[model samples]
Target: EVMKQPGTNVIEVADAVLAVLPDLQAQLPPSVHLVIKDDNSVNIRKAFGDIRVTMLVTLVLVVGVIYLFLHNASATLIPALALPFSILGAFTVMRVMHYSLNNLSMMALILSVGFVVDDAIVMLENTVRHMEAGESPLEATLNGSREIAFTIVTMTVSLAAVFIPILFMGGILGRLFREFAVTIVSTVLISGVVSITLTPMLCSRFLRVVHAKKGLAGFMDRSFDRLRSGYGRSLRLVLRHRLAMLAVFVGVLYATVKMFGIVPKGFIPNSDNDSLRVQLRAAQGTSYYEMVGYTQRIADLIKQNPDVDSQMANTGGGSGNQNTGRFAIQLTPRATRALTAQQIAQQLRGPLGRFPGFRAFVNVPAALQIGGFRGNSSFNLTVQSLNYDELYAWAPRLEQAIAELPEVEDVSNDMELKSPRVNLIVDRDGGRTWPPQKCQALEGRALRVA
Candidate 1:
């Protein structure tokens, strides 16, 4: 039986099933077997786990660096508090706006970790500077926050300006990124508010003065001071040699342009996931059992790889043709496997390419499948002609030419013209004069031929 949860996510539904799967399997007959044909829940769970790990690691590293520079655990903790507050607050807003906790939003939250802590760190640093100058914590908190309040606001607005345009982009790209951009902008704005309000309050209550000691932290601080001084001196030198600086800037710009032109580009980065969709097509006149046999052989070949967890083959539904079939290959989760779905697909392609009388294409599903974007393959070219014969004649040559391109791989055309047809002709006057049974016999013969 198939079931769906109306208001719950696929991950939740899968978890609910897993909780009872063992018991359910135990009650089944020894000869019967149960298999999940396709489960997107695993992908969702893995992606969420990865995002969580990324956020946690980022927070730890950020806090550790802050403590190293400030040499005070209390000061480090002040900025660290902003990370969760901003993220949780963003979640609250997301819930109210009806956004789910999907990969794009999770990625945005992870990326926002850097920006979310920036305002808090800046405010804390400024407050520490005033404390070092011998001001009381409360006074330093008020004055330091007041000093950088405008700066934080300006930073938030500038970041928002950059991401807000993405919300207005039309089509699949826009739909995929709109949630990501909104999550970032919202978290940054929340962080700004926290920096000026909660951050200063925490600093005033918890921040304390620390005396310098002879250690690695003190040595690093002294080195940083020297670096800042040298940078100031360089700035003054550049101001004095404006023409030389301009020439150097132009040379750097030219180098940047040339480097950009040399870099390879693609529509989307291939995700290293654990599932692949292998589409197979046999010759037009192939029998149903022959197609199934071919698909079973392909499945057997796929199962030879240790990473493969399961395989499901579906025949006779592809483009309404009996010769076409598809294999849904599931592999072990990415953490437990060394090869990605795409890599495994490539490895299998070598053997499948040698399979006689059949053509195969492999692709991983798209990360986000939106309207008009089927996401089944990497690229698609649509050919249209008013004349059917001309279209049929031109399509094969175009397909072959594209297949021969050095950069292209697994090229195939959707236009199939192998179905047999029969034309029926009758003398209208004589047929009208004939008995109805005679006309029926002629129609049956035409249908049999067709």
Candidate 2:
């Protein structure tokens, strides 16, 4: 019944609510029942599943590709081990920093998988090359790591430097990107540490001396050698024809810059969260039942949508405004539905748009509903003047102008001043003469009617 405060954890709130459910139910009459439903837990579980699945798929692919190239189980295992150690270490750092493993952070972790394994792969390959050149395992490990240590450190620092600025960005965007950027930087640094230390140690302990290869392993080795030679030849050719290469590079860069204007731009991308809200506002003088009727019609039409899982409506005193009500439509989970919450809201708009004597808006809630950015609608316009008469006079005309724009929909104004009210004034002498019981009775009746 109450809107959650900004930045409050929905899951924790739901848990606190459930913890006191037994006492609440006991205090209520037998005919009354409390049913608690929430999507936070479902959302959390889905986020975890998505992160797990994405990491697992990346792990499998990386392992497969490594095994295919190396053809040695021990060599592949060395680099693969970096994945778990780097991720676990990043998680530990995140705990220390009080970061939650939400969707954005998890995505950052997934992306870091590619970068994390790079240092390990480079060190392992270099060490293997030393071993193939007839050095002892310990000597190969030491020499190989020593040679690549600076390179790995530089790469890690460079990657971290790219994201560090994002942490200092201002406002909501800064908050959102800070977690993602820091997570990547932390994971990459951890991966670099594990690469130079654990990776070489494991290679020295478990890696075997290379022997003459045949079949698929030999073919892969020869193919890689050919690719390396070809790349070297191409590099030489490009260096020899510097002028032609420069022209081609400049032309490609210019084309890419020109294409930037064709890309769609927005502050934030739309997310499919499987929930929609419908705000209903009746005419200023509309009664509570009349508003309830309008809300019911809208809810009924929304229920007809196959993607809708459940819905709740509020009217009368529960609604925020006297002539306003709200409907919360919970759609089926994203996996079970093809349409996004925004699309479903658009579909329901047709029915709600036809409702008589009511203005309704259907929208998905914002990811973070901060001050002046409720996300209930696309845009908000405020008309302020020192004189109430001038403000009210111009507000409707402005609202109508905005509503007439081709891109605007569900336009509404909260400036209506025509609501009917009855003010009761009791004469001091008349009330002094009235009996206490009569005054009490009148007050009780007014309260009941209200």
Candidate 3:
């Protein structure tokens, strides 16, 4: 029976292997070992709960700051309430416009904090001013509303108008900034309405009667007196030699322009953080093990001084990545060391030069704000023309030119071209059957792509 079996296939391999390690063995010594595998999947519900807890804690902390800054709980509550109204309203607009709750949206929200408060601030300050000047709360509220009603309308309209044009912007830039503009415009519009309506109600109901303190008045009066005197002297000097001052100011302005030009015009400025990401890309088809090795080398270089508290690497590829390798590397803070993020990024880039295909991203936050892929630095070069041939020919030359630029990274033709292929020819008259068109079609189809 064993001779009838073909090679190992002819033999009962299961029986042969079982002879080495049998489960019901009366004939073998027991051997034990452990098998290992990786599974990163986890419970999603638990993750959502954790995120909620973190958000609650952060919100509570920020609310505490707001109260402290305003020095009044009611005042803080009134404005803080507006934050949600403004944010929610802004988010609603983004949703309607099919924008995501991404970095740009968050950035616009941060900016709105300062701006949304503007109308509210003016309303509250005006009411307070009227009250301080001896008017009743009712009178102060009505007069304040009347005073800035037109101003608020025009301002809100103007703000909204600014964003309306952005929706018409021609490229990805327009699409990216669209959310920023829309969010700001929407939140500002909502805040403006709240300022005119809700703010007046709160001013009347919540604001405490604050009389000018004698001590505070005396101190402010003295400070202003000195300021007035200084200003009066400066004004007199300028008036006395107006032409000389004008000439001097003009010369200074000219010098300032010259100085501005002297300062080298650089690309994006360094972004701040307690973290820096060093992205590594090796030649196509580099193995994960090789990438891990390179990452370790880069991490070791970073770990040398112990300033980096933590380091991790995640490897992946672009959408159409063939052989090109990619990595998302992170460096974190040390408990003992206090250093600016830009400084740390600079250090990482210095050592990363040893690994040729490495690019360091300092501002992870800013990259997101501009609506680009997270940590993606390379921008597209769009060369539109009536002729496709001219474009195809010029793209490589342009890519070469861009590659020569020290400031640019990942200089590419913005087009994908396949490697050349071999061809076999046959004459149909020599009793050969062939479809050259079909073969050519197959050739195009056979191009191996990622």
Better of 2 and 3 by TM-score: 2
TM-score of each: 0.86, 0.83, 0.52
Clash pairs, candidate 3, are 5-10, 6-10, 284-323, 284-324, 285-323
Backbone clashes for every candidate come to 0, 0, 5
User: Per-residue lDDT for 1-450 in model 3, tens only?
Assistant: 123243343124534643554443544445744211111112122334545565466556656765554455666676666667777888788888877554566666666666676677677767777888888888988998799878877877787787788867867678668778888788889988887888889888887654543564456657768999999999999999999999999999999999999998744554443455555655655566776676677667766745555555555544424323333333343334676665665565555665665443332333223443433343555687888689778888987987899976544442544444456564658633556776676564654433
lDDT of 2 by residue, 1-450 (tens): 545676787677767777898998999999999875445566767767878899789889988999998899999899999999999999998999989888889899989998998999999989988998999999999999999999999998898888899989989899889989889999999999999899999999999855888999999989999999999999999999999999999999999998898887877667766788887877777898888788778777888899998888887655267788877778888888888888888888887888779778888876555675343375566677999788978888898998899987878787768854567675898788898888888884544223
Distance from true location, Cα of 57 in model 1, Å: 1.5
Best by TM-score: 1
Q: Least accurate stretch of 10 residues (summed lDDT) in model 3?
A: 34-43
Considering TM-score, which of the candidate structures 1 and 3 is the better prediction for this target? 1
Model 1 residue 318 distance off true place after TM-score fit, in angstroms: 6.5
> Candidate 1 — worst ten consecutive residues by lDDT sum?
368-377
Error of 3 at 218 (Å): 6.0
